[model samples]
Target: MTGGVPEGPGDDRWGSDGGWDDGSLDATARVVDADSSEEERRIEAALRPRRLTDFPGQQRVRDQLGLVLEAARRRQAPPDHVLLSGPPGLGKTTLAMIIAAELEQPIRITSGPAIQHAGDLAAVLSSMSEGEVLFLDEIHRMSRPAEEMLYLAMEDFRVDVIVGKGPGATAIPLELPPFTVVGATTRSGLLPAPLRDRFGFTGHLDFYSTEDLVKILTRNATLLEIEADPAGVEQIASRSRGTPRIANRLLRRVRDWAQVHGRHVVDLPAAEAALDLFDVDARGLDRLDRAVLEALCQRFGGGPVGLSTLAVAVGEEPDTVETVAEPFLVREGFMVRTPRGRAASPLAWQHLGLTPPQGSPGAGAGSQDTLPLSGDVGRFSG
Candidate 1:
């Protein structure tokens, strides 16, 4: 949903306002460099699948993405702007990198928060080589001015530079190299309608199925040289919140357990023991996840509690609670959202081995109180 009216003074033309002449570009560059440290760069490079055939799951997205890149190659032109939306760690960043790799183009990585000023976005856009992929992660968090700048840049391959302050400011249109913008967001809903429409193709990644996750785990285990049985991989995959990142993380933990315990390989029993010790259930619920449900059922009386209240109880930011903890809780039928707030579902109580209060907003609740909570945000558990 669109946020309320803009606050403060400035012409909200999509990037014509020279408001970003501030040092936002330098700050963004620094942050991007920090994120691309030696270790992070190594891990991302090692794990990033080089081709669509190597990328796992999201068949529809793969097909569409393949066609877009192929068509762009055939025409010898930059590909259409692409939008990748899904839960965090569901491979949006990976797909963006893959798009660049597939097109044999360089990629410049940045984020919405990094481009606090329109000037920051302009600096990056202008610096990109022709046919490069500008991977903008967390695109939803970009400032208004920067987003506006991005619109003009994407549409016309140009940006207007304001030469002076105040009424005497002159607009200088600077042509940029033809490039592809690959926008990735965990909160696609927060994007402005105009910004969202600028993309030629949008790829929505869904939670991988248990089978898909198992395949991913098996592949990663081989890559990491960790010995794991088929059943062991299946067990880990089933408990990975249908996320490849979670599966990878769990595999690492299980490997540590196996090594310490002197097991030659990860077996089903060993996997179970390792997960139990880590407090991750077969359904992927961890300690904090269960704690959230328990607190709602026991302390808040099956809650229609506000998000802030839940965050306070859990000692997390409201964004973290809403984005990381709530998605899977809702998807597993453990939570429900009402006009009042968030309430515990019957499944939540059942998972916690507690019964809901009589007449609580459970199974037979009326249609009006049931707001469809998004399952994408809660996958990571912060």
Candidate 2:
């Protein structure tokens, strides 16, 4: 808003290397897309950890959640309404399922967008059985009316059913059975204060470590009945963009390559070939990601270029470049968003194998070593 400049993932869909930050650019890697397709989602469901013990990463969240669930179980009552927030593909849905399983309760799956009104949310909440877990995904996207209704339901285990409209309307209080609400969101900040406070526990999921991703891939390979070498699995892990979903997807894709090429097992070569075919590089940078980087390093001479111009240089829409490619590029330290526009970082120059010219931005010129063409440059904390 200051002189038409963007700040804090507000107005521009990008935060100032703080909120909504972290290396998750989170979209169109396709292979590493945060969003999922129906088939991909189906496969992901089959591969998800059914219990907390089986969940590979987020050790802190897992342990904390285990204590909470165990305490609730000991008390012989439904646990508090839980909130899981993080970048997509970090197993929020899987954890929700695990919570239900731990409680030995049935889970009713629904999303925020699905409940458009107070009545809609009330209908879903009122019919729930005692000890049931209502898993609300994309919890931040719920309509305000539904969210308000949820506040009362979560606090009092009751909902008010309106009999009529306006002046003639009668509020009939409906008592809901003891139940738990497990809400998952990628954007927790969008949630209102009242809605957020209603949740007893909030677990923020982070990107998986490479070792954790490796363990996940190995387990998934066995589940898929794919013979995979350690080296091959490691290769996949290294390129998974620090996300388990991406690792598993890459493993399955590599399995397909092995099956097609008559290889009995997924080896390093098979993994490499499959990844190459998909245009996902060693760093899990797909064509679009790399294209953005290439356009910056090569076309724009390491940039100071506008987002729109960068998008056009790659024959893509600006939003695509902004949301899909640029976030990853900036987050990975390969690019930076500057006052002037976008600029490549020193890492980008190094990754592209191009020389950062003397006296130009991102060339590591002068005394300071880091070069991002901005006053503040680092991965997002979110």
For lDDT, the strongest prediction is 2
Task: Please list the Cα RMSD from the true structure of every candidate, rounded to 1 decimal place.
Answer: 9.0, 11.6
Question: In candidate 1, which residue pairs clash?
Answer: 14-148, 14-149, 15-148, 15-149, 323-377, 327-378
lDDT of all the models against the reference? 0.78, 0.79
Candidate 1 has an lDDT of 0.78
lDDT of 1 at 231: 95
Error of 1 at 304 (Å): 2.7
Candidate 1: Cα lDDT at 319: 83
lDDT of 2 at 267: 92
Worst 10 residues of 1 by lDDT: 22-31
lDDT of 2: 0.79
How does candidate 1 fare on TM-score? 0.84
Q: Please state the error at residue 101 of candidate 2 in Å.
A: 0.3
lDDT of 2 by residue, 1-382 (tens): 3311223456443345332121111111112134767677567667878899999999999999999999999999998899999987789888988998899876666677767888778766755678878888888988998888888899998998999998999999999888998999988899999999989999999888889988999999998888999999999999988887778878989998999989979999999999999988988799899888888888877777887788889999987887677756766777777667787877777787888777566677422354444455432211
